[model samples]
Target: MNAEPRPQESLSGKEISPTDPARFPRLGFLLGLVVVYWALYFVVGAIDKPYFYGFIYGLASALLFAICFFTWWWGNRAIRRSEKILGFVLIVGVGVLVGKFSDRTVNFFPLCTLGLPLVATLVLGWLALVKRSLISSHWLGFAAAVALGFGVFDLIRMDGFDSSLKTHLSWRWTPTAEQRFLAENAASAAAVKPSVAKTVPLHADASTWTAFRGPNRDGVAHGTNVPTDWNSNPPQQLWKRAVGPAWSSVIVIGDRVYTQEQRGPVESVVCYDAATGQQVWAHDDETRFDEAVSGAGPRATPTFAEGRIYAFGGTGILNCLDAETGKVVWSRDTKNDSQGKPPMWGLASSPLVTDKNVIVYGGGEANKSLLAYHQDTGNLAWTAPAGQQSYSSPEIVTIAGVRQCLMFHDFGLTSVDPATGRKLWESGAVMKGAPRTGQPHLVDGNKLAVAVLDGPGVSLVSVTKEGDQWKVAPVWASKDLKPEFPDFVVHDGSAYGFDSSIFCCLNLATGKRSWKDGRFGRGQVILLADQGLLLVVSESGEAILQAADAQARKELGRFQALNGKTWNSPVVANGRLYLRNAEEMACYDLTPRRQASIR
Candidate 1:
C-alpha cells in the first residue's frame, strides 16, 4: 500500500495525454459525410422550385451543412467533458428546431426539412466514432433521434399535403406554340360567330345564350313565357340522352341545343335537337389534358350568335362552329394572344358576344388581359392589359347610359369600353383569392353585385358618372352571400343566390340578410324572372324549383333528372326546362296547361 501511494503521487506530477489513434477511419468518415451531404442536397433540390418551399429548403440546407462541417472539424478537440457534451447537445437541438420550423413553414411535397435531422445524426455519429473517448452513448442517441425525427416528419406530411401535387407534376412543361395557338383559337371560337352559309332558322325564336347569362347576359328572360310550376311524379321526361362528362349548361338556339362534353381524349362540342333532345351533330377534337376539377371537358357554355357557335374547351381551345352543322369555320388561339396558361380548373368563363365583336377575359399577363375578336372572322379586334383570368363570364352592360363591358377579374371589377376595349374605370375590388368563378350581377340598375366564395362575401358597388369619368364605390359588403357557382340575381331590391351549402337572400342596397334558409344542395342556379322562381339543380342530380323571394321561401317542386351530379344551371326557354348532370341531359315541358291540374 505504501509503494502504491508513492507511485500515485508521481503520476499526479506527470501530464496525462490520451493516445491518438494511428488511423481514425478518416476515409470511411469522409465517405459518410459525402453521402449525407449529397442526400441532403437531393432532398433540398426536390422542393426548390415553388418560391415558398425554396426559402425553407435553403434555410434547412444551410443549417445542415453548418452542423456537418463544424462537427467534423472541431469534434476531436480536447475540450472539457461537460463542455463537449453541452456543445453536442446544443448542435442537435438547434438542427432539430430548425428542421421542425422549416417543416411547419413550407408545407409542400416531398418534405425537404426531414434531411436536416438526418444530416445532423450522420455528422454526430461520425464525430462520435472519430472521438470515441470524448463522448459516450452518442451513437445510440443519434440513432434514436434520427428515427424519431423522420417518423414525426412523415406523419405531418401525410396530413398536411394537398392531393394537388400529382396533378401539378404532370403539367410542368410549358405548352408548345402550336398548343398555345390551338388554345387561343378555341377560346375565340367559343365567343365569336362563324361566317357560315345562310340556312333556314330551325326554330322561329332562335336566340343565343351567349354568356353564362343569356342573350342580354342577364338571368332575366323576356319575349318568352316559361312555366313556373311542374307535376309531382317525374313530370314529362321529353328526352334523356347520354352526354359526355361536363358541367357546362346547355345553350338553346333554334333547333340546336349546344353544349360541351368530355369523352376519353376529346372535349366534344355536342349539338342536340331542342325539341326532342336528340343528337343533331357533334365535333370532337383531341384535348389530351387530363385534369381533376371539372374533369377533362369543356367548361364554357357555347355562345351561338350570327350562325356561329363559339365554344371554349377545358384546355383553352376556342372553336367557331357552324350553327347548323358542327363544322369549324375559323379559330383563334387565346393562349397565344394572351401569353397565359390555363387556370387550374381550366378556361371555364363563358364567351361574351357584343354587337360585332366577341369579348372574353384572357387571364394572362401584358398584351392579353381582356380581348375582343371580330364576331364573323376570328380576327383580333382589341386587347386590354392582361390582368387575372377568372372563371366568371364577361358582361356588356350600360352604366350611366354609357355602354361598357363589365369584367370581374382576379384583381377587381374593371369596366372597359366594349367598342375599343379601352379601360373606362378600374376599381380596387381585388378579391382575397386569385380566381373568381361567379358572374357579376347588376343590382337596382346602378349597383354592381359581385360574390367571391372563401374570400369576401359579396360586394355591392355603386356605379356613378362624373361627366366622362365613371366612379365605383362600395355601398355594402357581406361575407354571408358568397356565391360559389351560380351568379346572384337581384330582384325587388334584394339579391337571391346560393352561398355554398345554403341559399341566401340579401338586401342589395345594404348587404343585409333578409332571410336565408334552404338545403338546395350544392348546385348552380339560374333565376327565371318571368316565373319569379329560382331553378336550382343540385350536385346530386335533384332539381328544386323555389320562389325567388326573401319573405316566403317556398319550394314549388323538386325532381331528379340525371344519374350523375347536376352542375349545369337549369335553362327555361320556349315552355321547356332543360337540365343536365355529368353524363345525362333531360328536357321537361313545364307549360302551364300541361301542369295546371297538379298546381
Candidate 2:
C-alpha cells in the first residue's frame, strides 16, 4: 500500500491523474442553489415592485460565475497554483466575452441570463462527475461545455414579450409576422394592375367612435347592450385583415374607420372600410419610427373633427388631412414647434380638436410645453409649460363647472384652456419624473383618479375651486391597483382596470381594493355601461366578458379575437366590437342576433 503510485489513465487513454481527481465537490451545492434561485425569480416577477425586478436577477447572475469557477477548482484534485489561476482566466474570461457581445433582445434578458449558464453547468457535470474518466483535463472539458451553451443560445432570438414579462422566442432565421405580411401584400398587389389608391366616401354613423376612447375620451361604450350569456348568445367575428405595426387604436366614423401605422419607410394614416376590412384610402409620409418593445408604428390614435383627420405621428409630425380624400390639409413638426426633444418612447399626443384650436403636448424647454394650433390654418395658436414628456394624449374634461383640457405627464395632472395654452391648475407633487400613461379619470363630479407610475399604484384626489385659486389634494393612495399604459374607467362607484396585468376593482371613495382576478395581460377594457358589463381584450388577443360588480369577479364568457400581442383598446359601437393591435384589425358582432361565429 505504501508503494509509489503510477500515473492514472483516463477513458481517453491519456495520463489524467494530476488534473482529473475523480471529484465534483461543488456539484451537490450547485444543484441546491439552482432550486432556490428559480423560486425567488418567480416570486419577484409576480408580487414585487417594478423597480426591484432587476436586483434579484443581477444577484443570481453573479452566482452563476461562482459555480463555474468552483466547479473547475474542486474538479481538479492535484493541480498547481499556476494551473488554478490559468483555469480561472480561461473559464471566466470566455464567459464575460460571450455574454456581453451576444446580440439579444431584452425580452428574454431576465430568463436567459441564468438559464443558459445553468445548461452549460449541467453539461460539464455530466462529463466531469458522471463520466469521470472521459476527460483528460477538467479545464478543456469546461470550455467545450460553455461553448455548446452559447451555441444553443446564438441560434435563438427573442420576438417580444407578453404582459407577464415572459419572452416570445423563436429560431433566429424564422420569418417575422411583419415580413410575412409585407410579402403577402406585395404578392397580391403584383397579381393585379398597379393603380393609385382611391378616395373613399365618409359619413358620420348613427353610433360612432370619433375619438381615442369615445366622444368624452372615456372608455364607455354607449347604446350597445352586449349580452353576457355566451353559451346562448356569443359574439361573432364580422371581418379581419392584416395591418402594419402601430399602437394606435381605431376611430370609427360611420362606414369607414381611421388609424395610423408604419409600413417599412412610411408612416401612413389609413382609412379602411368597417364592413369589408378593405383599404379605402391611405396617406403616407416618408418617415418611420420604431422601438424594440413597442415595435414600429405611429403611437397616437387619430381624431376626427369637422370632417378632417387630426393624426400625430410617433416622430412628432402632426398632420390634419381631409376626411374623404386623405389629403394633408396642414402639417407641423411638433418637436420643432414645442422646442423640446422627443421622449424615449416618442411624441404620443392624440391631437385634441376644440372649437377654435387643436391642442397637443409640447414637452419643450422654457415655457413651450403645450402647443395649440389653429384648426383651419396650421398657425401656432398658443404654447404653455407642461411636463418634459408624456405618452398620454390631451383630454377635454369639465371640472367644477369649468371646461378644462387635461394632460397627464411626468408632472402628474395638468389643466389648460383648450383655446389658449394657459395652465389653469396642476397637481405635481405626487407624480414628478415618473412616466405618466394612465388617462386621468374624472371620478364622480369633482374628484379625479389617476395612475401614479413610480408612486406604485392608483391615487384619488379631490379638485375644488376656492375663489380664484384651484385646490387639488390627495384623498387616498392604494398600491394594490396600479395601471400604467392602460387606462381605467369608473363604474357604479368603483374603478375597473388592470392591477399590473391582472384585472382588479378598487373603491373610488376609499381607494381600497375590492377584488382582483383573471390575468388578462396588459391589454385594454371598455365598460359596456348599457348592460353593466366589462369587455376586456387580453394581451394574447382574447375577448373576455365579465360583470361590473365590486363584490366579486364574475367572468361571464370569453373568446379569442385576434392573434399575437394586443395592447390597443377595444371600441364598441351599436352592436359591433372593433379592435386591433400592431399587427391586425378586426370587427365582431356582440349582439344576441349573432349566435357566435368567428372568421
- List the lowest-lDDT window of 10 residues for candidate 2: 48-57
Give model 2's TM-score versus the native structure: 0.86
TM-scores, all candidates, are 0.66, 0.86
- Model 2: CA > 4 A from native: 1-35, 42-127, 191-206, 362-367, 430-433, 592-599
lDDT of 2: 0.76
Q: Residue 464 deviation, candidate 1, in Å?
A: 1.4
Q: Write the per-residue lDDT of candidate 1 for residues 1-599, one digit (tens) a residue.
A: 44332211011122233352222224355457657766866774544133224445656665666576557545644343444565466555644554565433233223333444455555456544535443444445544654554444433322122211211112223442224434654664577554433233743253434445577666765544544455534356677766666668888775568888876667788887776655667888887444433344667788877778888776777788887888899777688877777876677767777868887766766647687888888898998863567777778788788888877777777788888988888775565336676766776677777775224578777889998777788786787676655566777788877765577788776778888787555566667776577777776678777788878688888878666555677776766777875567788776545542320
lDDT values, one for every candidate: 0.64, 0.76
Local accuracy of candidate 2 as per-residue lDDT tens digits, 1-599? 68765666432334645446632333454555555655665776676344224444555565664565466564655444555566557555655566565545422443245545565465546544634554555555656666665555566666665555556777877876777777876686567544344343454554888888887778998787667788777788888988888889999887788899888888999988776677768888899886554577888899988789999888888899998779989999888878887776667788888857888886866568788999999888998777778888888888878899988878667898787767889885544445678688888788888788337788888899998799988888888798868888889999999887788999987889999998887779889888889988998999999999999999998899999999998998768889899788999987857464555
Q: Which ten residues in a row have the lowest lDDT in candidate 1?
A: 5-14
